[model samples]
Target: MKIAIASGKGGTGKTTLATNLASYLSEEKQIILADLDVEEPNSGLFIRAEKIFQEDRYKMIPGWVENDCTYCGICQEVCNFNAIINLGTHILVYPELCHSCYACSELCPTAALPMQKQKMGVLKHYKKGNIDFVESRLDIGQEQAVPRIAQTLDYINSISDNKEIILLDSPPGTSCPVIEATKDADKVILVTEPTPFGLHDLGLAVETMQKMNKDFTVVLNRFGVGNADVEDYCKKNNIRIIAMIPDSRQVAELYSRGELVYDKVDSFKQSLDSIKHYILGK
Candidate 1:
């Protein structure tokens, strides 16, 4: 099964759940954990694995080929992102603003704008025991994350089959990156805190998932710290609450030290067990 661990906002424990859950499950089965947060992949911090492979990932963007042409205004007109602009005598291409839609390049009557590969990120694969971990990080100054995220997902699909469980540590929020990360997932675990802000963002995430027609459930993190509003909201909406990871100083300490808590904390292990049970049962 392909499962994605996601959050509506940052610091809600998506990585905490993803990393630990994958490690715990790898003991009995082969697990593939992919960190799809290309902008800032931190799941690798907790996983100590041997580097299996690493490669540079590139995205296609329109390159302005001055010699090829005509300062036709068509390239600029077809670009919805304003990535290309024609200045009567010259055509400018902004690599950062380009969405790689290829409209400008394909629609250019004079073919002045040509599609070219641009380095956007790097992907690293690691292996330890029965766990295969993949992390893709967007290069600094790269403006778009969806391309990197889509490439990472493509890589994951290329290596994955129907037997192994693939777990995605998706980027936080309900934006394009998160959508790309979770689009193919069989199930999604939306981790959220019990605070008001957490509840609010979780609602947005839930709506996004519902609109996408995805199977998902909630895992409340920092369970004891905030009020019962989150619980009330989930219950009212009839969303399944799979697990509740407690608010504890021990978990905080272990997390701060970059250690996995499933091996150190009993409550944390139980929470992970609950998640595993729910996922496997499905």
Candidate 2:
């Protein structure tokens, strides 16, 4: 089963649930924990594993070959992203705006535009006993995250078998990165706090998932700190909240110190157990 832990907004405990749940389950079975938040992956901070594999990830972008140029404006006209601009005598290409659709390159009359590899990110595979942790980090100043995220998912899916559980720690929000992260998940656990901000963003996330026709449930973090408005909304909307992690200073301190809290905190462990049960049952 591939379960994706995501959030509508940042700092809602998506990584907390992903790391702890993967750690707890890995004790008995093989688990693949993939941090799909390529922009800023932090699951590696909690998982201390031996590096087993590493590789640079690249994306295809058009590179102008002036030698073969015919001065035709087809390249510029075919580009929907405006990545290529024709200035009568010269052609300009913006790598950041290019979506790698290959339209411009394929349509060039003189083969002046050819697809070339551009470094977008790096992927590292780590192993600790039965758990396999895969992390992909985007290079600095990289504009598009969807490509990196898609590549990371492809890497994880390539290695994972049917029996092993795959946990995707997705990027925060309902944007393209988040969609790419959770597109193939068997189930998505949306983590959120009980505050008004959490409630609002969670609604947006829920709507996105619904529109995608996904099977998802809620995991309420910092359950005791905010009002019960989130609970009321979930109840009215018929959304299943699988777990509620209590608001605890000890948990926060441990998190701040970059430590896992399930083994030390009974409540936290229980919450993880509940999520595990849900996954196993499904």
Each candidate's TM vs. the true structure? 0.97, 0.98
Can you give the lDDT of residue 57 in candidate 2?
92
Put down candidate 2 lDDT per residue, 59-87, tens digits, no spaces: 89989888898878999888889999998
Question: Judged by TM-score, which candidate is best?
Answer: 2
| Candidate 2 lDDT (Cα, 0 to 1) | 0.93
Backbone clash tally for model 1?
0
Give candidate 1 regions above 4 Å deviation: none
lDDT of each: 0.91, 0.93
Q: Ten-residue segment with the worst summed lDDT in candidate 1?
A: 63-72
